[model samples]
Target: MGLGRGLAIGTLAVGLLVTSETPALAGNGPAYKDSWRPVKVRVADLLGRMSLDDKLGQMMQAERLGVKSPADVTTGRLGSLLSGGSSQPTPNTPVTWADMYDGFQKAALATPLGIPLVYGVDAVHGHNGVYGATVFPHNIGLGASRDPRLVQKIGRATAEEVSGTGIDWDFAPCLCVARNDRWGRTYESFGEVPQLATEMSTVITGLQGTRLDQPGSVMATAKHYVGDGGTTGGVNEGNTEISEQELRAVHLPPFKAAVDRGVGSVMISYSSWNGVKMHAGSYLINDVLKKELGFKGIVVSDYNGVDKIDGKTGFTPEEVEASINAGIDMVMVPYNWQTFIDTLRTLVQQGRVPLSRIDDANRRILTKKFELGLFEHPLTDRRFLKTIGSKDHRDLALQAVRESQVLLKNDHHVLPLLKHGKIFVAGKNADDMGNQSGGWTVGWQGTSGPVIPGTTILQGIRSSSSKVTYAKDGTGIDQSYDVAVAVVGETPYAETKGDRPQGMGLDDTDLATLQKLKDSGVPTVVVLVSGRPLDIAAQVGDWAGLVESWLPGSEGAGVADVLFGDYNPTGKLPVTWMRSAGQQPINVGDGRPALFPFGYGLHYSRHW
Candidate 1:
């Protein structure tokens, strides 16, 4: 079963799915502080006049705005606010989002200089905050394309969506060269290949736009500073055990690519390299990334990454200051800002952290805002709310969904599903956008119920197919069906909650579900949803047709389009599908076991 009339069917499928309405999750909520409109010079001079409390406030970024009202920008000295995906603006809507943002800017300006507050969000894939930003292909999909221009285009698109909604900084262009397929953040990466990461660095060109130092352009953030993708046992947030030389060879290339292209921000990772946390290690963050790489941009910590350093070295704030003296500029203190302020003040008062250090950090932040042209064009056209989930952006997602489907198994021409075939769809994942998008969708560890409105795989398939039956993990087997597709894979999970250092893979229950369908003597098709490839060896044989749909974005209906013979599968594995946890740290490109070489995927063929 090869792709038949793909272009013809794709055109039809897109026309149908294009009509679906998905709203942005953010709302305006109440008034926020820091909505100041000061000139750049005035903002800078204002920073100079601020006391230690006020200056420290400028460095902290929280999940929400810290102030209770508009009076707090200069009064309370709050610096920045961010939405951690799940943290929607109250009364969430596109207008409220703009209003909330303007509120923050209002406060920052209330200060003498009236500087605008730079709002940050994980708009990595799209205006992920606002419901309808064009959710492009994940970095992994872009990796498979090997098209730097496409990556840059995505960067531009992402910037336009995010900026149009009032966000000034985008924490994006995930520079991690995903060495391990088991890592949950795999989809967030360019690929396991260094060259792919190198190519994706072009995203900076899009995020920051053609000019590096310009307002209106969202500042490009190169993330996880060092070897975060090479975590031990493919764990989410764990140690990366590699020599610095090895690190420089494999993981450092992408970040360097961003640095070369002028990324405005670098976010520190939670993981450590060679027993030192990337955030805490003076040698890597300071001497290496800051000095050697010539990354003049501001370096910010991953959310609450400062806490880990104290946990690791039993170091107090003074030690924290030493890390700052080492290279780090701003801290993403998600909570507990008072401690950061008190500690920094104590450090400066004791001469442990110099005024020069504070000035340097503040200068970098201001310089980036200047370079990003944030001061000149601090406000985005809230009017852009009209275009939030526009037809064009959703079409881009459909294009990505069309491109990102990987043909993993097609035995005896069993796939490129026939619309007339009596197919039975079984699995909890079949209809859920939460499962398809995996981590970092509307919420951090996505769930199956009440996903921000979008067409699901089940909905798409039913719309296209003449006959279909659906069931969750365990349900009545559709005995009369000619084929059964068990759309299933890993659920939305992250960090230690989703972490499994030992024997990582899918659960036996999910495998048994496939076995049940296979035992029924039906040709089974398995459509998998996962952040990273799991130990599917036990389950692959149970299905005649297998597809590795690595967290296809809001356009998962495109997966159905390709699967149902509406489109051909063009996606290849961004990271190798490890046979088991033991074979991990798996990459299709390098140091991989013989189980499956890197770049092992089948393109759709007409042959049965």
Candidate 2:
């Protein structure tokens, strides 16, 4: 009379008979499969039915490349799938994304237990991985806006786009309190201050909505845990050599705020804390984050985060044991996830990893899955697909772009560019959508050119004025031109590639372009398109006007709005502007003489 997993066959048969399309339709299924039952009870029942392979598979997150076909989801019993920065489906359309999600979901349903696989993507700046998805300003620009409500709205818009694709997880709101602007990922932070990061945690509420089961809601991730922002020499994945108190004060507040908002997951950092790798840090992951702070959500490892624990090429068994013991509920093996699955199974059987730990992890992961209603509605919710790059969302991005513009210098009141005057625009970045959007755009590190649809800074200026001429190298301008606008600064890069180890000065081409405009006798207004503040102290005084446009994403009109007096400049410095590259690690309380202090910004005296 009993079923295969020891459930009464008659009860199971009855539960199965009344189902709609999805497995747990209207909570009608076996006790483990029932949606209406308490999540804990369902989790327990599911745990009881899982074998070693099943449990291990539930903890492994593989890249799309690792899976040969959609059937791989059921064959490997995989729990999750992700697209790295450059990874996308062929023809890369919104329809393609939905098809991919449904295909994978169908494969997951074919598994013996019918557990759905959760899909995660780095929609860090407005579903950025998707083409034509209305790219918004990056985090540093949002930080300048100093508008949590605006950020929350962005989060909501992002959730709708992600939900339209049938993706359920977003690895976003990189909450590192960037102590050094030289750090490659500084743009990912809201600001250098703990308060800024904490306030912006409203994005979590935006992404997850009032409840996880809501129509447009997606699970948000608080990532690169702990001290990635405070790494020594601003090196990527380097050591953060700070005392415990300093670490707690500067970097921990945003995460706490995220937990307060009930974030569903926390991705562990690849960096180290005082020479100890964070992936193996048991105190922070288990004792502090899980117990003291009381984060009941899943703790996921960063992309191949465990590989660097032993300072080796590939991950090791010791690394696996250390990471798992440190309370990493899920491992992002990315490629070779099957090896991870096999190794973890071996570790459990050998008693290196206890079965109880495995059970606890599964309990947490499955609990979220059940709470999200993934069992009943595993396919794409196509209703929200129309929201992608909608006019309303782009308008919000424009407002964000306007608010994020910081007026560093407006000498002799030369700004508030007149709409009728003849203008000359120059610089490699002035007309490129990819340059303004910065890293994590169409590609991983982001390439230069028109990679996506959006208003370029040149386009914004052209739209506003009747007479506008553009030259790439600041040529074809004389006294006849009223002003010369030179958009010059760092191109695009993320993480390790963005770090400036030897020097943080402008490149030769940028310097040459600036010199041409400065020598032309016309008032030169410099619009810096960069991820972080560069060492421009030597030549900053030469320009009549200076504006910090921190990777303003798709909407360049926001910068033009401020320039034309349509919007007053209000953005403050998120990180201190360095006097020289020597002040690499300068901060607010550090007592170092800065070119521009943190939280400094200028406004037009005459309001429009």
In the range 323-388, model 1's lDDT, one tens digit per residue, is 677677887776665567778888989998888788778777766665655555666656556656
Please, what are the lDDT tens digits per residue for candidate 2 over residues 1-608?
12334233323533544324544334435666666655665676677778989999999889887799988899999999998899889888888999999999999999999999999999999999888898988899889888999999999999999998899999997999888788899999988889999999999999999999999999999987898999988888999999999889889989999999999999999999999999999999999899989999999999999998999888888999999999999899889899888888889999999999998888889878987889889899999899988899999899999999999998888888988889999999899999999999967899899988999999999889989999999888788999889998989999999988888888899899888887889999999999998999998988999999999999999889988888989999888899999888898888999998989899998643
lDDT of the structure predicted as candidate 2 = 0.89
Q: Which stretches of candidate 2 lie over 4 Å from their true place?
A: 1-28
Candidate 1 Cα errors over 4 Å, as ranges = 1-54, 212-216, 312-315, 473-479, 588-594
Query: For residue 148, what is the lDDT in candidate 1?
Result: 76
Error of 1 at 316 (Å): 2.9
User: In angstroms, how far off is 403's CA in candidate 1?
Assistant: 1.4
lDDT of each: 0.71, 0.89
